[model samples]
Every structure is written in structure tokens, then in C-alpha cells.
Target chain A: MDLLLEIAQQVINGLVIGGIYTLMALGMTMIFGILDQTNFAHGELYMLGAYAAFFFSMVLGIPYLVSVCLAILVGVLLGLMYEWLIFRPVRGKDPLNAVIASLGASIFIWNAALLVFGGAPREIPTPFLGEKVNLLGVSLNVQRLLALAVTIGIILALYWWIGKSRLGRAMRATAQNREVAALMGIKIGRVAELVFATGGALAALGGALVGPIFLLQPSMGLLAVGKAFIVVIVGGMGSVLGAIYTGFGLGVLESLTVGFLSSAYRDVISFAILILVLWVRPQGLFGRTGERGG
Target chain B: MKTLPYRNLWKWVGTGLLLLIVPVLVRDPYYLHLINMSGLSILLAASLNLITGFLGELNLGHAAFYGVGAYASALLTMRLHLPFLLTLPVASLLAAFSGALIAYPCLRLKGPYFAIATFGYGEIVRLILHNWDTLTNGPLGLRGIPGPAGFINSKVEYYYFILTIVALSLLAIWRLLHSQLGRTFWAVRQDSVVLAEMIGINSTRVKVLAFMVAAYFAGVAGSLYAHYLRFISPDTFSFLESSTALAMVIVGGLGTFWGPVLGAILFTWLPELLRSVSEYRMIFYGLLLWGSITFLPQGISGFLESRIRKNCTTGVARDAHS
Candidate 1:
């Protein structure tokens, strides 16, 4: 009974964490879809988002909700700056150039954070801190449930925006064929910037939501980005829905591995699965066949 | 004309003598240490250039093979108490085998897919190093690794040891580039489909061979690193180390001979130069990386080559007009 209960708890925890992974992967996939460049610094943006939230709540004495909002806004602004300053000049160059540039940006941001905030982990006090609810004889943290609800709501909102809005249509059009979209009177450049900002915002939201659960630290971006890349690869680089599914699946798998197996091998199992997925379907689970490049 | 080969031999002898005379003239152990490190890094950067620059494969997890080589050599020497010289070849072979293993599954991937897959492979190696306590001793890391005996106990001796390895590896790589197999690698890089149709060459075979050769030299460097540092840990072979190696190749001018060497020297000493601005060293490093990619995408060596080519063309045009 105890084993079953532990397994159940692990699954719930994994699902909640998977929600954040889904958001991170979605951001990366969206950027890949539009720009065809893998933003190596996406993880750093996520880290910055967490820091933004931490600063707002801890330093500025804002409410948790206000902090989350501020984090998203800050993420969007930084994303815009990235597009304007670094990516704009190297727009048509080889994808490798962009990859290297993003790596530079990642190092720059991470080190800046380290210098400014120091290497110590910062805590974000949850709105529902110290509260636990029992479900099916298993004690579940209320903060985790809140994270799940927020993630689901955001995913639904994103789906509706992408499916029904004119801006979303333009973004999709640009992603599918930039030249054709431009010919059809779409401002492809503006759309790209918007997509990048949106992606950054989503990543920031993920970071802020998970800040309470995991301490906010500059180096925290490395692990999050590593796992997020796996999700992006497994879900296919350009598929939004694919990222969500694979993110959740990977989360559950990792949780189960940690629960049943050793915690040390958590990353090992995740990467093994990524390799297997790539071996079987190199295009990723939701990647369109023959969409070459990044 | 008859004495041309002899003249070339004499020139080579002069260069070798100059290299030997350099350390004695400097007489600074610190500079000698830097030279030794540069030689090892040259081997690493040059080997990495084979894949990233020549073959046009972006492998982000290169240090994993390096780590593999280090651990393999470290275990052989530490556990079996074998002679250090024998362990170098064993480590290189093991690393090559593992590189082949990784390449088999990952070669099918193209572009960023291959890059991401290799990244995963690197993480897996690090995780194993962290978790496999029975073999790696976990985070405690292996210590008391023996240094080279006799002359190598001194910094100048160690410089010779590394310089010899660097010279041998550079020669082997140069020869490989000039061989029929080297031509095939270039052909594959230009266009795999064209090479496949015209020459009936299996691009996969060429790629795997290039990857393995690169891994072999990296293993050699890794073994040297383990013995030089006299310590082995997972922290030493992080993604940051791999990225820096890749940066050296890119900033040196990919696919150009001597570019990586120049890049290795500049980048290796860059941090040392910025030692005064220690607080913002990494930030400056990041900005420099960005500036290099954004502005001088072809790298310093490439920029200089283009300038020389332009000047020569202009001079020839002027002469013709006159």
C-alpha cells in the first residue's frame, strides 16, 4: 500500500513538473517554427524569468500574482531585445551563426545574473505555502495543484490564440513560409519578433510558476534547458502540441525513475529516451516530415 | 632545383631547433606551463576542427569522448597500475570505439538534430560519471594520478612531451587531409548526394571515420590532461568546456589550416589577459563571442586571408593596366 501511495505521489509530482516542461518546450518549438534557429539561450531566459519573479516578490514586496505578471513582462522585453540587438543583424546567415550567438547570449546572461545576484539559490514564497490537501489517501501540496491549474489554463489560452486569432494566423503563416507570407502582405519581421516575445513570456511564466518548488539560481537554467531540449527534440522542433505531450510523458517517466530507481540516473533515463525517439523518428514525434534545417 | 628537397629538410630542421630554443630563452616556468597547455589545447581544438570545420558537423558533446578517454586512461593506470605510456593507446582506442558507437545511431540525424543528440550523449556521460560511484568514485573524483617520470617532473620536460604529441597529431591530420580519404571527406562536406551519386561513396562511412579520427586525437589530449592535472572529475568535462573548444574552432576560421592553432593561442590567453577584470571576465568573454560571430563571422585568420587575397588581386590589376 505504501509503495502504491508513493508511486501515486510521484506521478502527481511528475505531472505538475511536466506542466512546466511543456511550457518551456512550447516556447522553444514556437521559436524554432518561426525563425528556424534553435535559441540556445531560451533556458537562460527561463532562469531570468524566475529571477524576475524572485526580485518582485522578495525584494520589491509584491504579491505572488503581481510578481508572476512582472516576470512575464520582463521576459517579453528581454526577448524583444534579443531579437532587436543580436538576431536582427545575422538574420539571413547560416543557422550555426545564430546558434553560436545564442550561446554567447546565454553565457552573457548567466554570468551577469551570477554577478548581480550571486550564486546562492533564492526562495520564492508560494501563495499557498504550507498548505497540503489529501486526495485518495495521498497528501498533495496545494501549490503543486495551483501550478497544474495555471499551466492548463495557459495551454488552453495559447491553443485558442493560435487557432482563432489573426495575429496567430500571421505567425503561423510566417513560420510555414516567410517569403510567401511577406508576399501576402504579412510583416514577417514583426511577426518573428512577436513570436520570440511570446515564446519568452511563456518560458518566463514557466520559470516563475516553478520558482517556489525549485529554488531560483543562475545555474538552474542549465538543467532546465537540458531537459527542455530533450522535450523539444522528442516532440519535434516545430510542433506546439507535440511538445506538451512529450513534456508530460517525459516528466512522468523521470518522476517514476526517481521514485522507483535511483535519483542519480534521472537525467540518464531522460536522455536515453531522447536518443531512442530520435533513432526511431528523426523528425520528432510531431515534426513535419521533410521540413529540413533546424 | 636539385637541392629543393634538401632545402625543405633544412628549413624543417631550423623550425624544430627554434621550437627547442624558445623555452630555454624564456626561462619562465609560468610561460612554459602556458605553452604546454596551449599544445594540449591545440590538439583538442585541431581535432574538433576536423568535425566542425572540415566535415561541417556541429557536435556539442565533444568533451564526452574526451572525458571517456581520460577515465579510460585513468582507470587503466590507477586500477591496474600499468605504465602510463601503455595506457595512452588503450584510452585512445576505447574513446574511438565509443565515438563509433555514438556515431552509428546519431549519423542519421542532420543539422541541429545531430547537434542536440550529441548534447544528450554528453550529458549522459557526465551523469554516469556522477552516479557510477563504483567506477568513477562519484563527485569525490579520482586523485593521486601519477605525473610523468624523470624529465616530465619539470615543466620544460612536460612541454616537450606535449609538443611532440601535438606535432605527431598535426602531421597525421595533415596527411589525412591530403590523402584520398581526405578528398572523400571534403566531397561529403560539399554535398553528400553528389558524392553518393558520382563516386558511389557511402557518406555515412566517411562521416563515421572522420568522427572516430577526431575522437582518437581528443582521447590522446584527454589522457595527457589527466596525467598533467593528476586529477579526474566529471566537472572538468562540462558542456562549457565543449562549447569553448567549439568556439576555438569557429573563431580560428573553420576549415582553414592553422586557424584553430591561432584561435587556441588567442582564446587560451584571453582569460589570462582579462585577469585584471576578473569580476566581469565571463561577461566579457560572452560579449567577445557574440562580437566574433556577429561581425567577424569568418574569424581573424579568415579576415586576414581575405585581405591578402584582395590586395594581391588589386596589385595584379594595377600591373596589368600599367
Candidate 2:
């Protein structure tokens, strides 16, 4: 019974982390679904958001929530620039070229961050610093709770936007088949822009929420990108719902593994799951076979 | 065509002679070490090209093989007192095994999925290297790996040794490209499902073969690197390292034999030359990669070929290589 309670507690902790993963993966999936290219640098966009928010809160003394909005704005603008500067020119070339370009963008962002921000970790000034919430005898940090709440809010808003709005429907249509959607008079380029910006926005939100939880650093995006890739794969390539579910699943699994198993193998666990899921069920739990995803 | 063969042979001979005389001319240990690093970079990049260029898979986990080879050989030579020469083959074999392990699940996926899967596999290798402290010494790294047979006694000697490895690996790739397997690789790359199946070529087997061969040389590069540097660590082969290797291939020109070689040399030298301004180095490197891909899609060698021939026929020739 005690062990069960411990496991449950660990699970709640996992949920908090999972929420962040869900946001990051959602953004990545949106861009990948529309662009048919993986932004290896998506995490860098996330990183940019974190640094931007960090600067805003630390230097300008902006509130945490307001800093998050600033992070989203930065994310959207950077994402637009990435589309214009990186993916736009390589658009119609071999998809592999885009991959390389994304890699270059990733390196540029990562190294540029390293150069500008330095290697040291920076603390994101959070309003919830040293605040804790007691939930079922488990002490949860208030920052974690706020982060989770923000994630849920973003997911709900995204669902509404995707479900109700005309642009959202158009984005979904574009995702289903870019050529057909274009043929149907959808502005493919505009849709691409919207998706990229939204992707960036989501990633920024994730980064802002996470900055307060984990100390900020230039390389923070690398691990987030890796884990986001895993969640996307396990959740099925372009399925937003799948990404959310798998994100949470991976988070819980990671927490349980760290709690019961060796902490050292936690990363290995994700990689192993990636390989296993590919071998056993490449389509993922919710994915349709032969779907149009890379 | 008649003069082409003669000119190419002379060019090869000239380059070979140049490589031979460089050590004697520039006796500086730092330059020699840099040159050796270039040779290893060439090997790693070219090996990556075997998959991305020929096999047409955007695998993101190439550093896994390189790191595996380094750790595997480093352990053997340092712990068991095995000859460095022997450990090279053993380490490569270990890398090949891991390559084979990673390939089966990943080969089924296309495009970005393949890239991410390989990337994940790479992270798994790095994780093992980080956590498995007893064998890898964890983050502290293995030190004092002796050079090959003690004949590689100095930086120049080690430079020559690595140069030999790079040359042989290039020769192997060249030969492979001219063989039936090379054609099969192109066929698979063109369209894995239809043409390969029509020709009764197992696309999976061909991809795995390319991966194995690539892993072999990457391991060999890792082995040489470990012996030369006399140190090994998990951080040495990060995801960033894998991205760098991919950049070298892309910047050098994918699918061309000489492109990655030139790219490796230039990239290795460029960053080293910027050692004083190290902070801005990566930003420059990243911009270079972006600019090259955007401006020169076919890469430096490809551009040169087009300039000389006044046509893109060489690209076609590369595709239809015998």
C-alpha cells in the first residue's frame, strides 16, 4: 500500500513534466504535419523562448505570465524567420535537404545560444520560487502546478482553435493533404506560416513553463527536442492527440522508472521505447497504417 | 572521355604526392595533429555520406557508431593490452553490430521518422556511455591510450597512420560505388518500394549493408581518434557531433566521393583557424551550412563539376554509376 502511494505520487510528478512534453510535441507535430519536414531546430526555438523569457523576467522585472507572452511573441517571429530564411528556399528540393538545413539551423541556434548566453545555467525568476503545494501528502512545487495549468490551458485553446476556427479547419485540411488542400484554394504558404508560428508559440510556452522548473541553459533544448521526438514517434507522427497522450505516458513511465529503477537508465528507457515502438507498432497506438507522415 | 581518364589519374597522383610531402614540409606538431583530425573527419563524413548520399536515408545517429568504436577499442587496448592494430577491427565490428541492431527497426520508416529513430538510438549509446561507469569510466573518460604498435610515436607518425586509414576507406567507397551494390543503393534511393522490389533487390538488406559499411569506417575513424587523442568520453560523441558529421557530408556534396573529403578538410580547418574567436565559431559554422545549402544545393564539388563540364550531366553520371 505504501509502495502504491509512492508510485501514485511519482505519477503526479510525471504528469507535470509530461505536460511540458505534450506542449513541445504538439508544436513539433503541427509543423511536421504541415511542412512534411522535421525542424531539428524546433528545440532551438524553444530555447530562444526560454532565454527571451529569462531576460524579460530577470532584467526587466516582468511578471512570469507576462514573460511567457513575450516568449510566445519571440517564438512566433523567430519561427517566421526560420520559414523565410531556412525552409522557404529549400522548399521543393529533396526533403533531405530541408533536414540538413534544419540541422544547420539547430547548430546555429544552439551554438549561437552558447556563444551569446555562455555555458552557465541561468535561473528564471519565477513568482513561485520556494512555494510548494501539498497534494495528497506529496509536496508539489507551485511552479510545477502553474506549469501544468498553463499547458492544459494551451491545449484547450489549441483544441478550440483547431476545432472551431476556419483557419484551424484549413490547417487540418492542409495537414491531411497539402496538394489537395492547395487545390481546394487554401493558401498553402499562409497555412505553412500559421503552422510554423503556432508551433513556435507552443514550444515557447513549453520553454517558459519549463524555465521556472529546470534551470535555463543553452543546451536545454537538445534534451527537450530528443524527448519530443520520442513522444511524437510513440504517439504516431502527426496526431496531436497521440502526441499529448504519449507525452504524458512517457513522463509517467520516466518517473516510475526513475523512482523504482535506476535513474541512470532513464534516458536509455526513452530510446529503447522509441526503437521498440518502431519495431512493434510503427503507426503508434492511434496512428492509421499507411498515413501520409514521414 | 579519353583525356578525362588521363587527367583524373594525374590529379589523383598529384594529390597523393601532396599528401605524402606535407608532413616533411610542415613539421609543426599542431599542424600535423590538425591534419590528422581532418583525415578522421573525412572518414566520418564520407561514411555518413554512404547512407545519406547513396542509400538516401537521413540517419541522425552516426556518431553512435563513431563513439562505439572509440569506446570499444579504447577499452580493449587500454584494459587488455591488446595491440592497437587489432583493436581497430574489433571496435569496428562492435560498431557494425550496433549498426545492424539499429537498422532493422529504423529502415522501415522514411524521411524524418528514420532520422529521429537513429537519433534516439544514438542517444541510447551516449546514455550507456554516461551511466555504465565501471566499463566506460563514465564522465571521467579513459586516458593514455597508446598509439599503434609504438611506431606511431609522434604527431607526424600518427598523422600518416590516420591518412592511410582515410585513404583506404575512400578507396573502398570508390570501389563500392562502381560495383553492383552501388547501383542497387541508387535504385533503392530512387524509390525503395517499387524499383527495388521489381529488380528483386531487398531494399532492407541494401540499407543495412550501407549502414554496416558506414559503421565500419566510422568505428575505424573512432579507433584512430582514440589512439591519437589518448582519451575518450561520452561528450566527445554527442548529438551535436552527429549533426557536424552530417553537415560535413552536405557541405561537401552528398553522393560524390570527393565532396565529403574536401568538406571535412575545410570545416575542420576553418574552425581551427577561428580558435581565437571560438565563441563566434559555431555561429559561423551554422551560417556556412545554411548559406551553402541555400546557395549551392549540389555542394562545392558539385558546383565545381558543373562549372568545368558546363552541364549537370556529372550528377546524372553519378546516379547511373556502374
Candidate 3:
């Protein structure tokens, strides 16, 4: 009975963190799918999101919810900047060039952030921290609950926007074949801008949402980006649904590991799962195999 | 032809004499230490160049092999009381085996996927090094790692030792590049799987061999580093270090023989030069990386090569007119 309660509690905790992973992975996969470029600097946007929210709320004394929106706005702007500055230059070049460029951008931003924000970790105080709500024999922290709720809402909205919207159709077309989409009059640049904006927004929101849960640090993005990459890979690169499923699934698995085993081994589990997935099914769980040209 | 051979002999002798005299002229222990580190960095950058530059595969887990070599050498010397010479080979072999281990599974992946896989492998290695308390001392790092005894004790001696190893390794790499195997590496990098197979070459075996060679040199560098620094730590071999190695290769010039050597020396010295503002060094490094890739795609060596070629052509044209 006790073990069941513990497992249930772990699962709940996992889902909340999983929600944040989903948000980051969504942006990453979208960039991969549409732009056909990996954004190694994606984590910096997430870090900036947390920092933006912290600045707006803690430093400037703004409401938490409003700060989150502002943070998202910053994310969108940063995303557009990424499209122009980082991804644009390497477009149509060797995919590795983009990787190197983005890596440079990532290193640049993270270190610059360290100089600007200082190396010390900071936290955003929230009203949700002290409150807890009981749900089905388990008590959940309100902040965590809020994060989970917002995650679901965003996921649903993203699903709708990508599925039914005209712009989303353009994005889908662009992802399918950039040359054909351009031939059909879909502006590749516009689609790229939108993809980067959405990716930035999603990653920033993830940062803003999880700011209260985790300590915000300049180097926080390094680990988050690694995990996001794991999520992206396991979910099958460029697959939105894959990112979502793997995000939550990895979160749960990680939470269980932390609960049952040691926190030290939590990341080991994710990476192990990544290697295993690559070994057994290189295409990922949902990704189609041998679909890409070398 | 006889004159050409004599000229080449003179060049070799001149360069060798210059290298030997450098320790005598600059007697500063600090500068000597920097020179030694430059040699190790050259080894690392050159080894990484083999995979990223020659093989056209980005192995982000490269520093893991370096770390593996370091820890293996440190432990072997400290615990098993094995000689430095023996530990060096054994550790490098272990790293080569690890390279093969990582390369086998990652055979199917290419480009970003391969990079991501290697990144994961690196993190796993780092995590294990950090967590495995009994073996690695769990982040506290191994201290007082015995230096190669008997023949070498002073910094100058260490410099000469590293100089010899680096020159030999570079010679081996140069020889390999001129061989048929080297041409195959270029072919593999061009289209890799399809083109190599079309030409009756086994791409898989070639890739594995390339990875082994790269890892072996990286391992050698790591061994030298462990003994020279007389310490070993997991943090020393992180993703950051791997990127730094990658930067050395890229800033030097990808797929060029002399590029990494120039890059390694420049980078090794650049950090020390920027020690006053050490905090901002990484920022500068980042900007340099971005700027170089964007503006100077050919890197310093490539740029220099082009200029030299242009000058030679003009000179030849002028001579013809005369």
C-alpha cells in the first residue's frame, strides 16, 4: 500500500517536470522538422525565459502571470533573432555547419549570461509555492499543478494551431519538402521565422513555468539542452508527437528512478534509455526509419 | 630531384634544430609548461581532426576517451604500480576499444543524430566518472599521479619528451594521410556510405579504424596530460573540453594537415595570454568561433594557403613574361 502511494506520488511529480520537457522538446522538434536545423542554443532561450520572468517579477515587482507572458514575448523575439543571425547564415550548407554555428551561439550566450547574470543561482518566489491541493488521495503542490495545467493547455493549443491553421499547413508543407513548398508559394523564410518564434515561445514558457520549481542559473541550460536532445532523439527527431510522448515518459521514468533509486542515477537512466533506443530502434519509437537522405 | 631531396633535408634539420633550441632560449618554467601543454593540445586537436575533419563525423564524446585515458593511466600508475610506459599503451588501447564501442552502435546515425549520440555517450561517461566513487574518487579527482620517472624530472625534459611524441604522432598521421587509407578517408567524408560502397570499399571498417586511430591519439594525449599535470579529474574531460578541441580543429582549418597544429598552439597560448580577464576568455573564444565559421570558413591555414597559391601563380606568370 505504501509502495503504491509512493509510486503514484512519483508519477505525479514526474508528469509536472515532464510538462516542462514537452514544452522545450516541442520547440526543438519543430525547429528540426521545419527548419531542418538543430537549435543547439534552444536551452539558452529557456534560460533567458526564466531570467526574464525572474527579472520582471522578482526584480521589477510585477505579477507572476504577466511576467510569464513577457518572458514568452522575449522568447519569441529571441527566436526571430536566431532565425536571422544563427540559422540563416548556414541555411542550405552542410548540416554540420549549422550545428557548429549554433554551438558557438550557445557557448556565446551561456557564457555572456554568466557574465551578465552572475554565476550564482536565483529563484522566483510564487504564490503557488505554499499551497497544496488534494487530488485522488495524493496532495499536489499548487505551483506544480499550475505548471501541469498550463502545459496541457499549451499542448492542446499547439496541436490545434499546427493541425487546423493555415500557417500551420504552410509549416507542415515546408517540413515535408522545402523546395516543393517554395514552388507552391509558401515563403520558406516566413515559415522559418514562425517555427523559430514558436520554438522560442515554447522553450521560454517551459523555463518560466519551471523557474519556481528549480533554481535558475546561467549554466542550467546546459543540462536542460542535453535532456531536451535526449527527448528529441528518443521521440524521433522532428516528430512533435514523439517529443510529447517521450517527454512525459522520460519524466516519469526519471521521477521513478529518483524516488526508488538515487538522484545521482536519474540522468544515467535517461542516457541509458537513449542508447538502448538507438540500439534497438534507431528510428526512435515513433520516427520512421531510413526516411532521410544522407 | 637530388637538389629537392637535399632542400627537404635542410628544411627538416632546420625545423628540428629550432625545436630543440627553444627550451634552451626560453628558460622560463611557466613558458616551458605552456609549450608542453601546446604539444598535448596538438595531439588532441589532431586526433579530433581525424574524425571531424577527415572522417566527416562529429564525435562529441571525444573528451570521454581522453578522460578514459587519463583515469586509466592515473589509476594504473597509482594503484597497480605499473610503469608509465606500460600504462600509456594500455590506457590508449582501452580508449581505442571504447572508441570502437561507441562507433559500432552509432554506425547507423549521421550528421546531427551522430553528434547527439556522441554527446549522450560523453555525458554518460562523465556521470560514471562522477558517481563511481570507488574507482574515480568521485569528483574529488586523482591527485599526485606519478610522473614518468627516471629519464625526465625537470620541465625542460618534459618539454623535449612531449615534443618527440607529438612529432612522431604527426609524422604517423601524415604518413597515414598520404597512404591509400587516407584517400579512402577523404572518399568516405565526401559521400561516406554510398560512395565508399560503390568503390568497393568497406565504409564501416574504415570508419571504425578511423575512430580507433583518433581515439588512440587522444588517449595518448590524455596519458601525457595525466603525468604532466600530475592530476586527473572528470571535470577536466567534459563537453566543454570537447567543444574546445573542436574549436581548435575548426579555427585551425578542417581537413588540413598543418591547420590543427597552428590552431592548437594558438589556442593553448591564447588562454594563458588572456589570463588577466579569464572570465571573459570563453566569451571571446565563442565570438571567435562564430566569426571564423561565418566569415573565414577556410580558417587561418586555408586563407594562408590561398594567398600563397595566388602569389606563386603571379610569380610564375611574371617569370614567363620576363
Candidate 4:
């Protein structure tokens, strides 16, 4: 049957680029499971929330659903100015000094967006960029079924706001034990500034839903923060549905290794499956080998 | 305990004769190419301050073992012609055999899972030196090379041949940080389970001998930066050159022996004195690496060694009350 409908249209274009790498590895595995601090400028705040939804739908023309809620309110006001000017004065210092001050605020917001948006790349326009559909006989691409229906409606509204809110049970009691979530009363630095402003508003709604379909630049947040750190190290660093099932199983195994190997070894097969899953499961894939310290 | 005191051996032979007569009184081949690019960024910020400031370990892919010792001394001196002082000890033994083969399965993971498994083995060695390009010519990198000729072709003989290989790798990392195996690698960085119960000392063989002596002085500063900028590429060892060699070992203060030479001479002359804010030079190098980790976290040589240990404990308590 036409090679099972061309391997089900290359597994629905590798589950719509693994539903935009599971909405940019669900805001980098919920700010590395409540601020263990990777945020190496969380892919330059998902390239400044796709240039704040491309300057709100191509320079204030608006309505691409109100420029994806104004690129998640400018990625929650640049994740509350990166937790009020860099992680509330280096919270509990020496997590390698907040990973070298979030890699010097991701090389100062990618060289201040290469000095106010210049290192080229741009393009936004979406409303299903030159649509397409078909179905059984296959064909696809209505912007990869609207990026798999906005990544299954933002992974079922971040699994009902992280399993029914109360600020998601004080961000799962401050990621299990921030001094037993500050001795139960919670307020562990306002649940790490509401998990770094809901992980910089879900990495600026995954750079305003993968900026139309990949263009915008300023070094496109270093290969979407190195494939969202190989989908939060093969989905484990404090799980969030194992970074949405290992960011759609590493975006359908890097779109079946760029359709049968060699899109210049598709980011060397996702950095050799992130150094062979940190040499065979260094507590990833839903971690918990004694939640090895932050 | 006070043995080696001929006035501290004439202050270590007058600081190795003022680092061999201050590059022959400033010969100025653009200040000996900014003192041979601050002796290859003080041998990559003193071997990334011996794996993140003397083994507290947070190696976010130390410029992938200084770009695997500058592509193994630029492919053994451009396709096996060798002899740049035998391709600097075969690019510091192929960057200490790829830092003891990625520190024997990543020092069996610790903190930030060994800094995201050495930032995924420095982006899988810069994506196999950018798609192997039939042995790295991929990103059109490796270029001319050949420099360190007879007496290293001038610029005051390659600034006294990279200041005699950065004073013999800073006197073999100050004799492996003043050995008794450098106090069991500073008691496995202060307290690896009380230096494995008061001194049995293994702490994973002193963190794989401080990650093979900081990947053998970052493969002799990537074989003197592939014989002084013959040319290299993989965007000159990115991860923003391992976050400017961990911001010159945390703004030059971490574990102090002249804090990665005053944080590799003020983060390589503060991007050449903010090259006239050439387009907000990386937003003032990200506001001087977030204002030197938010207000000098013990940097400027640990704020001048805690004001010279508070003026030598108030001059030995006013010379014991006179």
C-alpha cells in the first residue's frame, strides 16, 4: 500500500517537527525543573519570543491570534526581566554562578539581537503559509497541521496548568524540595519567580510557534537552544511529561535522520543522542536516580 | 614546613626573571600580538581554572578541549608535515586523549549532570568538526599554518615562543597545585565526602587527575592556537568559546592562583576596551558578564586576597600587643 502510505507521510512529518520540538522542550523542561538553572539564555528567550511575534504580527498589524497573545506577553516580560535582573541576585550562588550568568545573558541577548535585528533571517507571515492537506493518500503541510494543532493545544494547556494549579501546587512544591518548599509555607522565592515567568512564557510560545516556519534570526537561538538541549537531555531533567515525550521522540528521530541519514548528519544525530543519553541514562528519561542534586 | 625559604627562592627566581625580561622590553608587534593573545588566553584561562576553578567542576564544554587541541594541531601540521615543535606534543597528546576519553564516561555524572554532560560533549565535538568534511575542512577552516619556524618567526619570536609554552605550562600547573597530588586535588575540591573519609582519597582518582591536567593545558592552548592563527574554524571553538573560558574562570577569582591571570587579563582587554561600543559590543559583553557575576563574587584576585588577609590579621594583632 504505497509503502504504507510512505511510512505514514514520514510519520506525519516527524510529528510536525516533533510538535515544534515539544513546544521548545516544554519551556526548557519547565525552567530546568524549577530553576536548577540551565537557562543558557533559554534559546535567547526563544529568539525573543519570535521577535515578539514578529513585532506583533508584522509590525502591529496584529491578529495572528493577537500575535500569539503578544508573544506570550513578551515572554512574560522577558521572564520578569530574567527574574528581576538575573535570578534574584544569584539565588543560591555557585550553580556555576548561574551557569556563567546565563551564558552572559546569552551573549547579551544574542548581541542585542545582533544590534537590533540585523544579522538577517526574518520572515513571519503564516496563516498557513501556502496551505496543503490531502490525508489518506498523504500530502500534509498546512503548516504541519498548524504545528500539530498548536502542539496539541500547548500540551493540553501544560497538562492542565501543571496538574491543576494553586500555582501548580507551588511548582510541584518547589521542584520537590527547596528546603521542603521553604518549610511548607511555600514562597520559595515566589516559586522561583513563577518558574522563571512560566519558563519565559513557554519559551515565548515556542518563539511564536516556530516563527511562522523557521526564519527569524539573531543566530536562531543557537539551533533552538541546541535542540532544546537535546530535548532536555532526552527528557528527564525534571520530566514535564518527559519533555513532551522526548520532544516528540526527538522530532521523529530528527525527521528520520533527515529522511534516511545526512542532513549533514542532522546535528550529528542530535549530538549523538546527547552523548548517548549522557552515557546511558545518567538519570534522565524521567530522571529520579535520587534526583541527583541541581 | 618553612623549608624552601631562601626568601621564597628569590621570589621564584624574581618571578622567572620578570617572565623573561617583559617580552624584551615591549617589542610591540602590537604589544607582541597582545602578549601572544594573553598567552593563548592564559592557556585557555588556566586550563579552564583546572576544570572550573580547581575542580568544583562546571565545565560547559571547555571550548571542546580547546577545539580538540585545535583540530589535533591542525591535522598534524596540515596533513602530516608535522614539526611545530612536534605539533606541540602531538597537540597535547590529542588533548589528553580526548580528555581521558570524555573523562571516563563523564566522571560518572554529578552536578548539573556534569554540566549537561560537558555540554553534550561540546556539541559532539563541534558536530564532528562540522560534518567531518573529510577530516575537517568543513567550515573552510584550517589555513596556511607553518609559523613556529626555526626560532618561531618573530613578533619577538612568537612572544618568546608563547612565553616558553606559558612558562612550561605554568610550571606544570604549579607542580600540580603544590602536590601531595595537589593535596588530593585540594581534598577533592574541599570535601568529596570529607576527602573520602579524611584522606583515603580517591574522589574518582582526583577527578580523573583534574580532567587530565585540564585537558593537558587545553591541548597546549590548542597547539599554540594552531601555530598562531594559521586559521581554524568550527567558529573558532564556539559555545561562545566556552563562555569566554568560563568568564575567565569566573571574572578571575575562583580558586585564586592569580585568578586565571587576572581573569585572562580582564577578559582579553574588555573586548579591546569595548571597541568603541561597536554596536553595543555584545551588550557590553553582557553587562560585563552580568556585572562580574553580580558585584564581583570574590574576583579581582578575590578582592585582592581579602585585602591582604585584612592586612595580615591587623599586623599580627599589633605585634602581640607590643
Clashes of each: 0, 0, 0, 1
Candidate 2 residue-wise lDDT at A64: 83
Most accurate candidate by DockQ = 3
Model 3: per-residue Cα lDDT over B1-322, one tens digit each? 1011344688989998999999889989999999999999999999999999889887788899899889988999999999999999999999999999999999888789899999999999999999999999999999999998898899998999999999999988877776788778877774666877898999889899999999999999999999999988899999999989988888988878788899999999998889999998888877777777877776788778778878785532110011
**Per-residue C-alpha lDDT of model 4 across residues B1-322, encoded as one tens digit per residue:** 2122355698879977987788778866776688788889988888878777767788888888888888888788778888788888878888877888888787777766687778778888887897788888878878887776777677777777788878878767766776666656656764464645565877777788788888878888887887787888898887778877877877777766668877887777776777777788667767677778888976677777667768786532110011
Q: List the residue pairs that clash in candidate 1.
A: none
Model 2 DockQ (Cα-based) = 0.74
Give the least accurate 10-residue stretch of model 2 chain A, judged by summed lDDT.
A285-294
Q: Give the CAPRI rating of model 1.
A: medium
As for candidate 2, its clashing pairs are none
Per-prediction DockQ comes to: 0.74, 0.74, 0.75, 0.26
Deviation (Å) of B242 in candidate 4: 5.3
Write one digit per residue (lDDT tens) for candidate 2, span B1-322. Answer: 2112454688979988998989898878888888889999999999999998888888788999999999989999888989988899999999988888888888778787888888888888888899888999999888888777657787777777787888888878877877777778888884556867787988889888888999999999999889888988999998878878877888888778788888899889988789899788878778777878888877888888777777555544442243
Tens-place lDDT per residue, model 3, A1-294, is: 778888999998999988888899999889888877988889999999999999999999999999999999999999999999999988998888878888888999999999999999999989898899887778889999899999989998998899889999999888888999999999999999999999999999999999999999999888999888889889888888888899999999999999999999999989998898888888878789634211
TM-score of each: 0.95, 0.95, 0.96, 0.38
Among residues 3 or more apart in sequence or in different chains, the pairs in candidate 3 whose N, CA or C atoms overlap within 3 Å are none
Candidate ordering by TM-score (highest first): 3, 2, 1, 4
